[model samples]
Each structure stands twice: as structure tokens, then as C-alpha cells.
Target: MTRGKWVAGAVLSAAILVALVVAGVRIWDVHQMTSDWALWPKEVPSKVQFANRDYQCGANPMPNTHSLDGLTKQGKTAGGADIYSAAPGTQSGTATWIVIKTGQATYTCDLMGGP
Candidate 1:
């Protein structure tokens, strides 16, 4: 190919490589964010008096997420005491529901600017 064409091809290849790298990095970051326990808050609903329905009836098994890769379930800690969101873009502030030992659900969310 001509010198000009070769240079253009090289630039295009470099651009494509850069784009791929950026995409991969972003994916990795998202994975880490969702799996991070520090980002998750404590007090997740562990036990509740469901007057209407059971929390374990496929409703409170755990926080689930639907992403491009498909449904991703939250992972429990090594102790298997609590669960957390494993997929990013699932919740607004925190991942799924936190295991709250005691608290008023409607009182206020410190992170969501509640009372």
C-alpha cells in the first residue's frame, strides 16, 4: 500500500486496540464495584414478618441483577452470613437489600437523603 494509506491503516488499528482496552478495563471496574463489600451497607433484611408474603418465597432469596451478561446473583461472604449484589447497575445507591437487624424501612435512608 501507499505510504499515506499505510499510515491511516496503522492509526485505525491503534484506535481499535485502544477502544478494546478501554472496554475491557471498564468491564473489570464494573465487576469489582458490584462485588465490593465496602460499597455495600449493613442492615440488610435478614428476618421480617411478612404479613402478606414470605420473604424466602423467591422474593428474598437474594438480590438478583439482569445485565447484558444475563442474571447475576449476589454473593455471600465467606462466613455465609450476609449477601450482597454481585452485578453493577442493579441498585440506586447500594446493591440489593441489606441485612438490617433492626430499623424502620420508611423512616429514612441515610444514603438516599431520607429523614
Candidate 2:
């Protein structure tokens, strides 16, 4: 192969490698953020009723209202708890009332507003 062509191929390969590394790092971050809540038992109910309102696990969307990964990234931490909005940002009345107990391997949801 021509020297110039070989150099071009090397540059393209390096670019692809950089892209893959960036993608992998992002995926790893997301995985680490959600791993705590994602492994909760499916048979166990994560729902909680507080103030006559129903609040479910915020990790998964199918059975919950918000993504845990999104919550962890965007939520605020206070008094050993991670507080997040009950609903997604697009929705109105998204109260930052959902609290998750932190500093443990697994998190427990406390809709009652306690850490």
C-alpha cells in the first residue's frame, strides 16, 4: 500500500478507537449509576404512598416514572439522601420529593421524604 494511504488508514483507525472509548466510558457511567437500583427484586414492590400520592421506583421507566440514571445525575444530595423529582422534567408538578437512602450498596426508596 502507498505510504499516504497507510497513514490515512491509521488515522481513521485511531479516530474509531477514540469514539469507542468515549462511548464505553459513557456506558460505564450509566451502568454504575443505575446498578444500585436496577438489581432490585422484581417480585418486591417498590411503590410507596405518601400524602395520598403514589410514588414508585424512579429507576426503571416501565414500572416507574423516572430513570434512576437520569435521577442520579440530575438529582440533589442532602443529609445522606438523594432527592429527585417524582416525574420527568417535561411534566409539570414534578416535585423533588422522592428520596433515596444513600451510602449503601443498595438504595431504598422513601417517599415519606426521609433519608
Candidate 3:
């Protein structure tokens, strides 16, 4: 084989290897993100009423309950649930609970224990 042909083959092989590695990394990342959460027995409600306003949990962009209406991130539970305070200056009595599983986030007005 010509020297030029050999070099081209080597470059093509390297490119393929790099592409495979990148794809594998992305897949691993997705799996990690999804599997990191602990399982919750009950499904997250589609909508939660807080401060007399309904917030959708399953929407494309999850509500930023952590920073919305004076709600702040209290902390993460052992089961990987993110806890947020209710909106300030409102009669919302309970803290918000957020759990992520299978790459989707669900929210509730009650505190759900962590994994």
C-alpha cells in the first residue's frame, strides 16, 4: 500500500475510535443522572397547589421552586430529594419536595424522604 494510503487509513480509524468513545461517555452520563435517585413509591403529582397558584411539575422546564416566590433550597434528603421552602408571605404551609428519576423531575407540596 502507498504511504499516503496507510496514513489516511490510520486517521480514519482514529476518528472512528474517538467518535465511539464520545458516544459511550454520553450514554454513561445519562445513565448516571437517571440512576442516582432513590425510588419513590408514589408518583409525583402532575400539579401542585401552593399559595393558591398551581405549579406544574412535569413540564419541560421544571419550576424553579428553589428560587420562586421566596422558596429556597433547604437541602437534599438522603434519598436525593431536594427540599424547598414554601413561598414567603403566603399561607402555603408545607415545604416543596423535588425528586428526579429517569431523567425527569417531579415535585410535591409535601416532604418526601430521600433514598
Worst 10 residues of 3 by lDDT: 33-42
Q: Which stretches of candidate 3 lie above 4 Å from their native place? A: 35-70, 73-96, 99-115
lDDT of 1 by residue, 1-94 (tens): 8999999999999999999898777655543433223323233322221212212212133333312233243333222333322256754544
Q: Which ranges in model 2 have alpha carbons more than 4 Å from their true place?
A: 36-59, 62-115
Model 2's TM-score against the true structure: 0.39
Cα lDDT of model 3 by residue, 64-96, tens digit: 323334456544433345545544555445444
TM-score of each: 0.34, 0.39, 0.37
Best-to-worst lDDT order = 2, 3, 1
- Give me the displacement of residue 9 in model 3, in angstroms: 1.2
* Top TM-score model: 2
At residue 49, give the lDDT of candidate 1. Answer: 17
In order of TM-score, best first, we have 2, 3, 1
Which window of ten consecutive residues has the lowest lDDT sum in model 1? Answer: 106-115
lDDT of 2 by residue, 1-115 (tens): 9999999999999999999898777655544443323322232224434334444554442323334643433342322344444345554553434544344433435443432
Per-candidate total of colliding backbone pairs: 9, 0, 2
The per-residue C-alpha lDDT of model 1 at residue 106 equals 17
